[model samples]
Each structure stands twice: as C-alpha cells, then as structure tokens.
Target: MPTITKSNIDYDKRNLSDKALLKLYYNMLKPRLIEEKMLILLRQGKISKWFSGIGQEAISVGVTMALKPSEYILPMHRNLGVFTTREIPLHRLFCQWQGKASGFTKGRDRSFHFGTQDYNIVGMISHLGPQLGVADGIALANLLKKNGQVTAVFTGEGGTSEGDFHEALNVASVWQLPVIFCIENNGYGLSTPTNEQYHCKHLADRGKGYGMDSFILDGNNIIETYSKVKKLAESIRKRPRPILIEFKTFRRRGHEEASGTKYVPQELMSEWEAKDPIENFRSYLFSKKILSAEIEDQYTSEIKAEIDAALDSAYAEENIIPNETIELNDVYKQFEYQDIKPNSNVKELRLIDAISEGLRQSMEKHKDLVIMGQDIAEYGGVFKITEGFVEQFGKGRVRNTPICESAIVEVGMGLSIAGMKSVVEMQFSDFVTSGFNPIVNYLAKSHYRWEQNADVVVRMPCGAGVAAGPFHSQTNEAWFTKTPGLKVVYPAFPYDAKGLLATAINDPNPVLFFEHKALYRSIRQDVPTDYFTLPFGQAALLTEGESVSIITYGAGVHWALEVLENNSDISADLIDLRTLQPLDKEAIINSVKKTGKAIILQEDSLFGGIASDISAMLMEECFEHLDAPVKRVASMETPIPFIGQLEDQYLAKGKFESALRDLLSY
Candidate 1:
C-alpha cells in the first residue's frame, strides 16, 4: 500500500464532526502548553527532567481520541497528550513527576514510567520494546472475553531494531490479535539517526514480513491521523487482527531537555517548525470557520491556568521520605499463608505428575488460568509434563507459543495485568536468559513501581543432570532470589511440588517455580489427589538430630537424605527450604541454634549462589550458638560439562558426603 502523506490524504472527505474536531484541537493544545510550562519548571529547578513532545503532539492526541476509552493503550515517554486526552488527573501526574507520595508509584518511579488500571493505560519502561508484547497480552485477553477491545502500543523507529518488536508482531499476526503497533518515526533514537537504526525505508514496511497490514501517515496532520486510526480501530474490532501504522513525525526538542538537539540540521528544524502539528491544525480549523482566534486564546489561557493550579496542588503534596517499613510494604501484595491439608484420596506420583496435577486442579478452579509455552500443546513439551493438557483443557487454556522467550514472558505479565493468571514454561532453565529482561526488569518491578500485580508463574526445568550440557541443564534460581517482588519455589519431593506449585499459582505475585529435570520421574511419593497449598518462607524438617543443621532444597534434600541414611553415626537436622525469596530465616536460625553447627548446600556454582546469603545469615544470627564455623557445599564454579563423569564432578553430590564428614569431625 502507498504511504498516506498529507498531500494524498482526502481532506474534503473527512468524517469527524465539528465537535469532535474542536475537542481534538483542545486535547492537542493542552499538552503542547503543558510541555512548555514543564520546560520552564525544569529550567527553574522545580522538576528534575522533562521529555518534550513539543512538536509531536498530534500522534498521541489523534490516536487516543480515535480509540474507545475501554481499549488499552501502551504509550511512550513523549506521549503526554495520551495522559491529557485520557483525562488523568493533572495534579497526580504533576505529583508523580515531582516525586511526591500521592503519585501513582508512591514516589517509587519517575516520569511516565507508571501505569494506571483506571485509565486502561499501560505505561512504558525505559526499555521501549517490551510494552509491545504487553499489548499483545491485553489484546489476547480482550479476544478471549470477546470484548472487541483493541490495544495500541507505541514505539519509535529505533525500537524497531529490538528483538521484542519483531517477536511481538509475529505472535500477534499468527494469533490474529487485535493490536495496533504504533510506530512514531521521530527522526532519531536518543542520539542515533534512523539511517543507523534499520535498513528498511520505513518501519511500517517490516510489518509486511509478518503478514500484517501496514500504513504510513503524515503524523503532523491531526485530521488524517485521527480519521485513519479511527477507521483502522473500527475494522480491527469487527475482525480481530494486528495492524502496523508508522507516523512520520519529527521531535521538535531533544530526546530529553538535558540532551540538546545539536545533531539536527538547522534547515531541517526550520522546515518541521513551519509544519507544526498544532499550529497547522489551528489554521485548518479557522479556515473551516470551526474556531476563532478569540476562542483559541481562551483555550490557551484556560490550559495555562489549569497547569499552574495543578502544579500548586502538587507542590502542596508531601514528598517521599525514606522509611524502611513503608518502602518494603509496596514491593508485593501480602499473601496470607494457609496450611491447607489434603483429603484421604491419595496416589503414588512422581514430581512431574504432581506438578501436572497441581496445574490441572488450578486450571479447573480458575477458568482464567492459561498455560503457554513452545511445543506444549499436542507435542506435550520437551519433558512431556503437559502431555494430556491440550486434550483436557482445549487449546484456549493450553496454548502453544513461538520460540520467543522475551515476548512470551512479557505477554504473561500483560495477562496478569488484565486480571488473568498465566504460567509460562521455559523449555530449559538455562534458556531463561532470553526471557530474563521482562522477568527481572518488568514483572519483578511492576508491583513496586505501579502497584500492578504480575500474577504469572514461570515454570523453569533446571538443574545439572541427564547430560543435557550447559545450554539445557542449569540451576539459575539465584538470579531471581536476589530480585524483590518475586517468589522463588524449589521443591524436593512430589508432595512439596504439588503443594508449593498450588501456592505459587494462587499467590498474587510473580513466581519462579524450578522443577529439577532429573527428579521429574525419579522419586515417587503418596501425594494426595485433593488440592492443597504450602506456605512460603516455611522450611520442612526431613530429619531431627543434634550433630549439625543441613540447610538445603530441591535435589540437595534427597542427596543429604542419602548421605545421612548411609552414615547413621553422623546424625543431623535436615531442613528443606521450599521457598527461596522469602527465606525461612527463623527455621534456619532455630535449627542452627539447636544443633550448634550448620551446612548450606545448593546445586548451583559456589560463588554468588543462594548458599552465600544463608551462610551470612547463619553467621549474623546464630554466631554465638555455633559449635563450628558454617560450611557450604556447592558445585564447582564452572559451566556444567556434558560428559557424564565431568557433569557428575561439576555437581554438588560428589562433595556432599565428604563436606558433611569434615563438618562432623570439626
């Protein structure tokens, strides 16, 4: 299709009513004036930073006005008109910009780095690409609900280079989701020009490769942009599908006020300034006798007065004070621990079966629960854990995803934001590196930043066994345990696996559920068929003795049990910590205080592992009760080898018995 430039657009055939036209003009003018006021505030040192969308107001205003208020929009930093058009409270927005407690983030974040459920807007993170996938999730939810609600996500031409951009577009196209990929070609990404960003002539052209319809618009023409986007949104609502629209615009100011636009040519700046969206649109309205100079002046005066009053109200709000208790409270929603017991019906099942049962039960209980992963549908996944899920739940609940880990993970977060729970499976635990950004940066920080709950459980099949080599077998749980707003669950036995998995699914936070690939079919226990939940931050005592306290979890628990059973003379207390993030510190301390010695064991490499934290905790809390120095047994600090003997040597089991003997002798 041909690019829709201003000269080619049919101005005389426009369909917007005069009232709507006037309202759009007011919305565009408001943000432009607000940005000018904010720039002054920045110079006067009232606000620390400002991202001026001074000349690029039409894209945000037109797109927001075109969509229904119930449809979601994920906007970028410069889209201030989106907030203003959505009618977000100016005082609260100013308070947010000024780091006040009354802000959406409670002063935890700055600028447009927050989202509000009330407005159906998901704000962008500094990493500009992930929000596209989040838009996919919201669109997917709308499709399932048959709400005919479309999701529009924004990014710049530079963001088109990100892998997430491609992945999200491809997934949306394949799934035929109702999404509008809005790309604002704003000349440059920070300092890099568009020529250096992508080889394509226009970012919208890339959409054709994904089998998606594409369009290009003269972004400065507010009437053309609004009419085109409105027609596009209407078509998408009738027949759900993804569309890419490239808004050809120019940023009048620097990426931020701090970054001066020295690289932009003077001639180019003069040309764009002459075609200013708001000014040109104002002339159009005057020519059509839809607006007068008196009314325009009145609108400007009203907008300036409104901004000043909002700033005054924001200044009256209290600033954020650093308090350990209050700061920690917002990290995650509090979950009430319930020690639910299983009924009389029981059967022997392996760890994998228990987990499958837990997921099945949760799916039956919560209709909104979805399980997405590559090869998880008819293929049953790499480990066959989801073998019969598709047959039981159908393809809607049991869905298959592309090999796009990063986008899929963010899609799960978007699902959570839309009040649906999702479980994303990483084929191998080591593959989480691809999905790490959304999990650690977006999902982990969502609740703390905007009180957004990421109720998604990521199933990680981790550990070094089965000779799967470095790419497949890895115990990377430590990566997330250090990250706040996330729960890490690693269970040793089938009983704990079922119960803990249930709790993780039910919890209103992001959870990393690690299932040892080696233990999937190895150990079996009489697990209750009835649904149950195990509390986090609670350790299970496998054995009771006084020689030493063995703190371990996952596969380490079974190894410790084997060693203790073989050497009865070396009696010890074995503690299986089911959850890692909410560490069972009280259990560890009490066990160490009773036994007077402790040994922390883990399957991960020695340095930077969870063992280091537990060792430090034992030293700090139970130093006086210790009869000997704390001991740590972990795998060698190297990549897990593929050879059977080399892999065995790289694991913790080889040194477990020897380490315990030395600690006992000490």
Candidate 2:
C-alpha cells in the first residue's frame, strides 16, 4: 500500500537492483539492435519496409518493465521493445518481419501488427489512436472483476490529436479505470511539427482537463522514466484511475526506411542524436558500475549474433499460403445456439419492447453482459427502447456513456477481448459515421487479425418514415454489410428483432444490429417470451408467390408486402434477408429460379447499396433462369429532405409496384 515519493527514495539513488538494472539495459539493447538488423534487411530487399524505433527504446523498455508480464498491453508500431521485454522468441519476431508462415499473424500483417495470446499483448493496427480506448475497455474489465490488473497503451504525440485519445481518457477518468496512456512526444507527427499540431504547450497538460493524473518525464533518462511509471502503475492497480504520461523522446531514424529526415532541421537531429535513449542508458549504467565497457562489448556481440541467427532461421521458413487461410476469421469463427424452452403461449409485443425484452433476458442469462450508450439507462435512449432497464439491471450493468461514437466501439472491442459481452447503442444509425473507424478497422477485423472475438452487439436505429431528415433517417446497413468481418442484421417484425438481437449478443464475433426507427411503434407481432435465437445468414419467406421474387429487409420488407397486397394479379415472393454479410444467397437464387424474375429493394441509396450486391449475386447464380434483368428500387442519390413530401418524392413513393410490374412483364 506504500507510495513512492521523493521524500522516501532519493531521486539520484539507484532504485532497481543490479539484476533488474541489467534486465532493463538488455531490454533496451535488444530492440535497438533488432531494428538496426531490420534496416539492413530493408536495404538488402529482404523485407519490404521497416519502421525503426531507434531512439525511443527507453520509454518502451521502462514502461514494459514497470508492469507485470501477466497484465495486458496494447502497443503501437514503435513499441517493439515491449515484445523483446516479454521475451517473445527472437525467431517469431524475425518471422513476422520476414512474412513467413511461422510468424504470429502467419504473414497476414507486417511490422509489429502481430499479437500472441500467450503473452497477453494485442498488437496495434496502422490506425494508431483507437487502441487507447480499447485499452480503457481492458482496464474496465479488470476493474469489474477486481483483478488488480492494469493496461498500458502507447501512442505518439500526433495520436493525442485524434478524438479516440480524448474519448478514451474521459471514459477512463469517469469510470476510474486502471490504465496508463503513454504518449511518446518525439516533437513531430510523421512530418508535421508540434507547433502546427496543437496550440497546447505540453501534450501531458491535455490530461488535466480530463481530471487524470498527468506527468512529463525525460524519455532519455532511464532512472526517471522507470521510477515515475513504476509508481503510477502500482498506484492505479490498487485504486483504479487513468494516468497520462508524456515522454519527451525522439525517433533517431526516418519514419520508415525510405522516408529521409530531410524535413527536420540539422540542429534538431544532432541534438536528439547526442541524447540518444539507448546511449544515455548505457552511460547511466556505466556510472553506476552496473555495466563496464568490457561487458557492453561482449553483450553487443552476443545480441548481434542472436539476432543474426534468428533472421537466418526466419528466412529459411516458407511463405504462408494466403489463400489457405483466406476463409479464416472472415466472420464469427464459430457460433452455437443457446438452448431455450419454446413458449407454448406466445405474447405479442412491439418491436421496441421486444428488443428491450431480449436485452433484459440476455443480461439475466449472462452476468458479464454490459449495456453502454448515450441516454440508454435513465432516459431509455432517444426512443425509450431501454426503458426501465436500469431498475432491473443495476446502473453498473445498464450504463450511460458520454457522446463518443468511436470510443463506444473501441471500448466495446476491449471489453469483448477481456471476456465481456458489450451491447452498444448508437442512439441513431446515421451517427455511426462518427465511430466508423473502430467498427470497420478494429472491431470488424479483430477476429480475423488476432482470433480476438469482439463479442459486441452494436444496436443502430436506422431508416426513414418518421421524418428525422438526412442525419437521423439514413439506413447504413449497406455500409457495414460491405465489410467482410461484421455480421449485419436489419430485422423488420418484432419476432425477428427479439430473436436476432439475442443471437447477435450470444454470437462469438461483432454484429451490427439495425432496427428501423419507423418499425418501432408501427409493427406488432407474437414474439416468444422464452429465450429464442434466430440464425444469421438466413431469410424469412413472408409471402410466397410465382411471378417475381421481392428481396428486401427492415422497412423495405413492409413496403414490398404493401405492394404485393395492393396488386392481386402480380404474385410476388417476399423474402426478408435477416442477416446481410452471411447473406442467404441460396434462397435468393432459388426464389429467382422459381419466379423467373427478381426485385432487390431497400431504403438506402440506389448506387453502392445492399441491392447492388444482391443484384450482382443474382446475376451470377440465376442469370440463365431470369426472364428479364433484375430491378432495384431504392432512395435516390441525394440527402433525405427535411420535408415529408419532398422525401417521398425522392424515395419514388409507390414505385415498387411499377418496378415489379415492369419486371414481371419483361
């Protein structure tokens, strides 16, 4: 329970023991030399590219040593020293850079974009700042479990400018999570200097606004860096709270091997060179007599020899056949249905009520389930979908969040990684654009990238009819369906909404669940009270006919049904595609083959929409059986107008009947 302060241990005194000092020194040395070796390989054309962490070894080594190896770390590209300190086999590291089959990601990714489940380290993507929020999620998970584990996340000074950085800090501060947000302030964001990047003097000062404990440390000084980080890490583990530390460091090499340092002034480069992190550490160790010149020379030779051997071994390995693992991690790796007793007496419920019931039942079933969104708890969201949720499930379980879209998904990814099922509400589907990076880049590809299942259900209330206008009325299911790894479900009726949401929450991967705003109060159906799950990638045959196959989902299903009801002559087969990504291609093909005609309808834009993909698929499969070309009826390529009459005109109101009539006649 003791805290480290200047009053107790002298600032100049050697805090770490001789053995610990040597370990820290070696941690810094190994990655510095490994980078040099990689640069050599880059020049020799053995590796495609390299991002050298030449002068930033102190921060990486210092932080890694501060935390226990059991704790999780979300490291950026430059933190190769983290891998080395964890004693990741040198061959595995080399194999990753060599793009060999034996690598962590099996040659799927390059540089430090690989993670080993055994080490509890999740490697970063090219999009740098989102990991901070993911780290916050991991920390939140630990706090919830009372595990006393902390998460250390790394980013550059440039990354602080990103919205994810601020969002993550705010969440960590509000929730009092055990996370350390380490910023490596090397004075430049790739090419842009610090002055142009932010008006604030110090990056660490930004954390004060979030009410987090912030510090500025000399990144080149090993003793100072180690002492401060070690204390902060210890304190946060006991009393969970975020700590922001800005390490004033330098990257001695180019951003990449090909990018020269011509943009930087000669004086700046020379100044950083003289105060090199690794060299400065060596001088400190020599001053303490922990490492002599003789030992240093012997150690360098040994490290160089080890790296060379590892590179040689990596080069000898075969390249991974990318096609062999092409199908792997594309969607939920595996899924299983929950056994529930079917209700003999079904109860009729509205779409919104059914969704809330599904959430309540899911939370009751799984203790690790957590609900997160803006106004979702007290106000029951903008639509009261989660009405009375907080009373049933305590505020801790049914939580309200700050208006942070990107962090919402990013935090969900982290919580999912830490074995928590997160049900996130986006208030409105149109606002999903604000938080699209984590969903598209991080959450969608998580399973594929690292076999990390983001057990997250992102509830998006979508579509028009309520006259919410451009920002609120947009149906963005097509955007997510286009993404490979995410399972997109846009249900029409109350039964499908309840069942699909349950299935989505219990599924092993990330799912984007879209509920039409118009259907919330309009539709009512007999939904089973007992826990029931609907399978993904399957379509519901609402009304079967022979003339044409009407394929649609969400609000489009109702529109198609209305057309079918009004016209008795035209017998159309109404098919609702419940799931989008794992699309029911067989059903569509069968329907088109039987009817000899097809119509793909949706509320999204005409160009580059879900109908487009369906049309392409139908053409490939049922092209020979079709009597005429496929017809797609969708909203025009313009913003949804604020005026109801104008919106109807833009949507081509009552056009589905005409489109179907034309297709049937052809």
Candidate 3:
C-alpha cells in the first residue's frame, strides 16, 4: 500500500540483462512519445481529436509485453501506447488518428479502438465497461481451446458503475474464466471525478462481492505492475479464472481528443506529475547502470524520431479504404447473419421440433455452430427440444453447459466473436431474466459500435401454460425488444421457429428467439422437409375475414389461430408478426386498412406488454385506418399464479376469442 513513487529492479533474484531492461525501458518511452506525438497532431489540426495516456504507460506496456499474441487484450482508448507493443504498426496507428484506412484496424474501427487480429486482440470496444464482458467471453473461448490464453480488459473507475461490469465479473467468477479486469482509476470519468461518483471507496472492493480475487496495484510502478501481473497471469494460465485489479493512477492529460481539463485541481495534478511512470522507470534503469547515458539519450532520440516520422508518413497517406482492402481476405466473412429467405411453399412445423431441427441443420451447414445450455444436450432441453441431439451431433457440437446462466450467454457470445455461430438455450425462458447483460451490452450493441457482428441465437422459452408458475414460466420478449440493438422473435408454431431460427442464426445481429414451452409438445403439425424459409416482417393472415386484424406472435399465435378456426364467420385476420424489431408495421397497417379494425395480443401481463408499444405505433401511423379503437388482449397485471386454473385466468384465458367476437360486433 506504499505510494509508488519509484522502485529499483532486484538484480539478485532476476539478473537483469541490460538489453532486456533497455527493451522494457525503451517500450515505456515509445508509447509516451506516441502520446506526445498525438498532441502535436492535435495542435497542427492534422488530427481532429486524441486522448493521451501519459502516466499509466508502465502497466500498459508491461501487460503488453506479457502478452502471447494469442491472448486478448481489451485496451482503453487513451492507452495508445499499448497498441504499438501489441505489434500494431506506428504508421497505421497514426493513420487511424488521421482518419486514414491504413491505420491499425482499417477505417472501420475508430482510431482509438484499433485491433490486431494477428496479435489475437479481438477488436476494442470504444464504450466503457462492457469490454469486460467481451474479455470474460474471450477467456472462456481460450479455456475451451485449452490454448492457455488470457484476456486482460482495461477499464476506468467510472466503468464499475455499469451493470455490465457487475454481470461480467459475476459470470467470470462462476465459470472461472481467465479474465483480468484492469481498472485504471485516473480520478475522473470524463470530468466527473470518481471520489464524487460512488460510496464504494476503492474500485477493487467491488470485485469481492462477486467472489473474485481483487488486486490493487500502483499502476505507475513498472517493477510492481509487471511482477504482480506476472504471477496473477501464471495462476490464470494454470487454471483460468477472473481477477480485478485497481490501478490507482492519475491522468497527466485530459480524457479524450477535445477534453477540457480546466476543472482539475492543480495541486492533485502536481502530486502525481512528479511520479510519472515512464520518467520513474527511466531513472530506475539509469540507477541500476542498466542504461548508459549515451544509450539512454540515443534510444530516446531514436524513438522520438521514429514516432515523428511515422506520424508524418501517416499524415501523407490516403484516408480512403484501399480498393484491394474493400474485400481483402474476407476471413471476417466466416461470421455473418443468415437471412431467412421468404418461403412461398413453406409448410407448418412444431416450434420445438422446427427449432431443434434448425439447430441440427445449422450445425450441419456451418462447422462453427455450437449449441449449449443446462440440460440441452442429453435431455434435449427441459422441453425436449434438444432431446437426442447429443447422440446425433457430438458433445462439442450440442454441448451440455454447466448451470451458469450468465457464463453460458457470455461464453456463447465470446465464441460468436471468435467467428462461431453459437445457439444458447434457456432451461426455461424465465432463465433469460438472469443473462440480460451480455445480451444487451456485448451482443446487441456490438454491431452498432464497431460494425462487429455476433451470430448468437438464444432460444428463450416463454409464456404461461401447463401450470409453470412465476419462477418456471414468463414472457420477457418485451424486456428484449425494448432495447434497440436486439432482434426479438416469438414463433407461434414450429414452422416459424425453424424458418426464423435459421434467419436469426444468419442475422448480423443478436436475436432472442422465443419458443413457448407450452406449445412445444401441446400441438403437432406437418412441417416441411425441403424449400423452407419465412420472411421476418411478413404476417400470416389466418382465416382472414376482415372485421378486425389481430396482431400477435408466439403462444398467442396459437390462441389467435384457434379463434380464427372456431369463429370463421366473425372474420378477424390473424397477423403473426415473426420479427419484432422490423415489426412488419407495413403488414399490420395494411391488415388494419383492409379489415378497418385492429387488436394486438400478448401473453405477458398487460402493464408492460409489447402490445403497448404496438398500440402507440398504430395511434401514430394508422389512426385513420381504424374502424374501432385499437384494443389489446394481454395477461392480467399480476405475477403468474400457482394454481393451473388461476394461471389460465391470469394468462390470456381464451381472451382473444372473446375479443374477436366483440370486434366482430363492431
């Protein structure tokens, strides 16, 4: 706990080769000079913006040196120095800052989020804390590969406040994933200082709540930072697990390219300014006689010249993506969203059977597809959706993951990032309530932030039937669709599940596939053997008669189908909206226009049902198309009851048929 001002290297225990020490000391300066070079660019107006990681170079450089190219490092935007150590070319780094495609990761990624696939660094996420989720996932993938790889995620003190940070730590601890959450506490989160943000004093203390080994390190001391992380990393390699390190340091510069650090206390800045990690490390090297004055000056001068030359070259390079790079390698093409082709000759299939079959075919079609969940392999899931899947596909293909819900989601997401198509099953759809973090933060927003796509499909069992009370059953599609980056689907029949699951797997986004456990075995129908596909936004007009159009999907689709069959003359078109985000609003409006009336239905409680969103949309787009006020049929606003009879009443108890009858009276 001593304040890390300066420390001498112990040559006795680890005889320092002057050459090795020179390299380490040299690396420390390269990243520093790069930061200073960035400031020159900022001043010259060559670079519109940049952030400088001046004080924290010791830890970032030390950690970068410890890497094995196969290990993943989630770096912060400010840590531009670490990118070079990971073998990211200096000119490319400069080009990225100057808005050129020649930059580290091409123009697709922000200059700050430069990633090198060659160094096994999965792309950097510019957003704050969520990279820890990706880090946990990367560790999970490395463990699965038995590749002795590690993922070190760098975040700031402000990141600990995000839900993703807590959720990631919890999962990494449970699964013992080889992830290290490095917190660079430089006092402020874009001007809101950490001291003013939280009651939890040290960021490291937050990890203990999730049962992780929390380490507080003096980020400015290379000797301490390197030695401590060396052992921690060794322990992780032995048997991967998550760790949190709080690097108590302060920023020498501002947050980002245009940050105004005027509010920073001058005294506080002066206190940390003297112990600048690079300068301290240089002094330590000189004290040990490891670097002669001539060599020290020579290396510093050479490094500064190299940085200046790289920046100059980067400034002169063209900013546009090269014609060759437009489709270069296309190894990234290995991972993509599969669009479900709309089928004109598609037949009906059972939801579970269709989904399971789709899983099998997807595994057959794509070598990278991995299916996992509690009881999914041998038992074919709780609903027997995956029954006999383990026998047909090997254990690795249809995996029986441990009972760690968040880990399952994160591991699957991690695999997806590593160019794999992963299908994760929820034992009961209710279990999805536990793993929402990775879904929303890492999976959902990945495409938007970095144009990074994850083809991870989650088969969520939803709705209430067969007496699955509160804990066993629930419809939470509303929770998913509320987020803009996710694709939510609730297939009423097996055929829709088959087609939509195929679409979901092919989709360039995170898809929440809701398959009602109640309807899994309750009904059976003729499913297609060949030529199968379903349009996401296209709604099915079941027994269309035209007094009212009822929009619903999933279990409610069954009820609407039944109502259509029972009262054919009453004439209500049942529109099964397979895709929620794309929503097929055009179809709904057309149905409402033809029928001149509308009703939306859902199995979730009426209070926060998706029907509300639809009702609001209809009022905005199609108020004139309505013959009567748009209506909604949803479960009553109560937690599902224990009694089967009560559950039926609590849920949508033939409510659609009655609503249809009332609408026909319109």
Error of 3 at 242 (Å): 6.2
Q: Residues 1-666, candidate 2, lDDT per residue (tens digit)?
A: 112112211235455788777777788999988888777778889889888788888788888888999999888888898999888989988888777867776666788886777888988888887899999888988988899998999999888889889999998898888999999997887888889889998999988899998999988776678878888888988888999999998877777868878889999998888777666666666766777877777779999999888888987887776684565534456787764545777898999889988988999988999999999998888899888889888887888899998887888888888889899999999999989999999888777666778899999998888888889889888788888788899899999888888899889788999999889999999988888888888899989888899999888888887887787787878999988978899999999999988988888889999899889988998889999999999988899987888788777345777887788878
Sort by lDDT, best first: 1, 2, 3
Query: Candidate 2 — what's its lDDT?
Result: 0.85
The predicted structure with the larger TM-score, 2 or 3, is 2
Relative to the true structure, candidate 1 reaches a TM of 0.98
Task: Report the poorest 10 consecutive residues by lDDT, candidate 1.
Answer: 1-10
Question: On a 0 to 100 scale, what is the lDDT of residue 432 in model 3?
Answer: 78
Question: How far in Å is the alpha carbon of 620 misplaced in model 1?
Answer: 0.6
Q: Please, what is the whole-model Cα lDDT of each candidate in the order they appear?
A: 0.91, 0.85, 0.74
Q: How many backbone clashes does candidate 1 have?
A: 0
Candidate 2 versus the native: TM-score?
Answer: 0.96
Q: Give the number of the best model, judged by TM-score.
A: 1
Tens-place lDDT digits, model 3, residues 202-310:
8899888988899898888776676678778888898788889999898877777577778798998988888787777766766666767788778879988888788
Candidate 3, superposed: residue stretches over 4 Å from native: 1-16, 36-52, 87-119, 122-129, 146-148, 155-275, 288-350, 375-380, 388-404, 469-472, 528-535, 605-629, 637-654
What candidate 2 gets wrong by more than 4 Å, as runs, is 1-11, 328-331, 337-341
Off by over 4 Å in 1: 1-10
Q: Can you rank all candidates by TM-score, best first?
A: 1, 2, 3
Each model's RMSD to truth, in Å? 3.1, 4.0, 6.2
